[model samples]
Structure formats: structure tokens, C-alpha cells
Target: MNFKSILFALTTLVTLSLAIVLNPQITSPSADTKWRAGDTRTVTWDTENVTGGPIPEGMKGTIKLGYLDPKDGPNEHLNWDLGSGFDLNKGSFVVTLPSELETKRTYIIVLMGDSGNASPQFTITAAR
Candidate 1:
């Protein structure tokens, strides 16, 4: 191949590699799955895509379980205690569903870090 063609191929490969490496991802709570309040479930993710950056103070990444509703404001954060020394880099977590939700609504599970990766839209059935 000509030098130009070889250069173009190399550039494309590098771009794709970076995209795959830097894209944040969530690995649990599949889209449209239902989560009932008061039940326990595992919230998990992989941060191999974080690349490099300075993580903010008190934030080494976190799983934010909540709704996508704009009216409710900030997506109605679920109160989850990640426990002491919980490593956001560990990529696995067992979580207890908060017992305060009173309505059935679709929710979004997000991996919070330098960037956020959202799970497939899931549902929170009426609190039980």
C-alpha cells in the first residue's frame, strides 16, 4: 500500500482503539429490568475505559441508581452506602434497594466517574 493509505489505516485503528479503551461501561442492571425497592441487587461496572484523569475529591467513581425524570430533579438519587473503603475500581458491588419509593417508574443506573455510563433504561416497580 502507498504511504498515504498506510497512514490512513493506522489512524483509523488508533481512533477505534481509543474509543474502545476510553468508553465507560456499566455491566449490570440490564435495560428494562425491574428493581423493587427494599430488595437487594448487585450494581456493577467496569472502569477500564476511564483512561487517565484526576478524580475529584471524595469521588473515586460511584454507581448512581435513580430515575431519569427531569421533573423529579437530579434523577431522584437512591441512597446507597457503598460501605467503607469501597473501591470504585473494583467493578462489583452488592446494593440494597432503598425502601422509600412509592411509585412505579423507569430508572437509570449510571456509573459515575470522570464520565458517566448509563445502564439500559430499567424500571422500579412500586415499593414493596
Candidate 2:
């Protein structure tokens, strides 16, 4: 390949990498996170890397709780709406775990709107 072609390819790769790194991402409720049902917990994310600054004020989004079914994949049938109309720029929100939630390690938090982001697998245990 010509030198110009190789240079163009390298630049394109770098740009894409930077774009991915700058996207909003979930920062809390990570893979090791564990919570008890019926307890109030906070979910947070990183906006510093978001392009054009953090999500603008008044821009809202929704958060949902999903489960990873061993037989299937991510199951959103429960439609566990944790919260809605949340200010995305706030970077965090509070959620109360449903007391009826099954004790499992495959629970995940999904932030929807604009560019959706999903947290790593977390655990939710039965309420005491």
C-alpha cells in the first residue's frame, strides 16, 4: 500500500478509538457490586469523558433493571423500570431495589437515551 493510504488508515483508527473512550459510561454498580433487595442504592456514571461536555441539563433519561437468563440472554421482559425522566447530567441517581427481586448475580442496570450504556453484572440478594 502507498504511504498516504497507510497514514489515512492509522488516523481513522485513532479517531474511532478516541470517540469510544469519550463516550459516557457507567461507573458504579460494577461487576463486583452487590446490594440487598429493598435497599436504596446509588448508580453513577462518568460524564467527564462525554463529548461536548456532560449531558446537558434538563436532558432526561430512563434506567431499567435487567437480568441475564442462562437459557437466553438479557431479559427485559420484566420491564423493571427503576426510574425515568432522570437528569442525565446529574451523573447519578438513587434506586430502591424491589423486595420481590430474585437473589441472583446476573442483575444489570441499563441507562437508556442518547447513547445507552449498561453496567457490568451485579448481584442482588434477598432482603433480610
Candidate 3:
């Protein structure tokens, strides 16, 4: 193969490897998940995908509640901090949904850290 072709192949492999190592895959709150306002739910991810094995001590991450209204076009709004300063290595955390949240099917959970990873869109219904 030509030198340029070899170089391009190597670069592409490195980039894909880095992406796999750096991005943690969210596993919970799946596409079929339905959470109720005022309820506590567990958010989980694949710890194996985390770089350097587990997250280091004192390394923290935040979880945010995101909203995308179909009526409002494609703008996604991260409107609330569900929790923060969490250990990303544990692979999971429990969060209490705010009782005041409106019933919506477009709610998503975003895990914020070195690289933000989001869960599939889920439903959040009004509290009973």
C-alpha cells in the first residue's frame, strides 16, 4: 500500500480506539424506560468501557436531566442537575426525580464528565 494510505489507516484506527476507551456506554434508562416524577431511579453504565479500568479517586461526574421538545424543534435543553460529584467507577447511581417535572416522553439522562454520554430518550410522568 502507498505511504499515505497506510498513514490514513493508522490514524483512523487510533481515533476509533480512543473513542471506545473514552466513552462510557449508558446502559440503564433504556429506550423503554418509564420514570415517574418524585420517584428514585438507578442510572447505570458500562464500567468496562471507562478508560484506565476504573475512575480514579476524587474524580467526579455529574448527571443532568435533558429535555427535547418536539414542538420546540431540535433544541435539547439540559434543564436540571439530577446529581453531581458522583464516582463514575461505581457504574451506577440513584437519583430522585423532581416532583415538579411535567409529564414528558422526551426526557433524557446525561452523564457529564471528560466526555458526555447520554441515555436513550425515556418517559417521565407526573407524580401521583
Predictions ranked by TM-score, top down?
Answer: 3, 2, 1
Best by TM-score: 3
Q: Could you give candidate 2's per-residue lDDT for residues 1-128 as a string of tens digits?
A: 99999999999999975564223688889999989989999999886787545566787878888887788855644458889898888889999878988899988898875656788888999888
Residue pairs with colliding backbones in model 1 are none
What C-alpha lDDT values do all the predictions have?
A: 0.65, 0.81, 0.84
Which of the predicted structures, 2 or 3, would earn the higher lDDT when compared with the native? 3
Best by lDDT: 3
What is the C-alpha lDDT profile of model 1 across 12-44, one tens digit per residue?
999975554233567778775777877888887
**Model 2's lDDT to the true fold?**
0.81
Q: What is the lDDT of residue 18 in candidate 3?
A: 58
> Which stretches of candidate 3 lie above 4 Å from their native place?
1-21, 50-57
Per-residue error for 118 in candidate 3, Å, reads 1.0
Worst 10 residues of 3 by lDDT: 49-58
Name model 2 segments beyond 4 Å from true: 1-23, 51-53, 74-78
Q: Could you list the CA RMSD of all candidates, in the order they appear?
A: 7.8, 6.5, 5.5
Best-first order by lDDT = 3, 2, 1
Clash count, candidate 3: 0
Clashing pairs in model 3? none
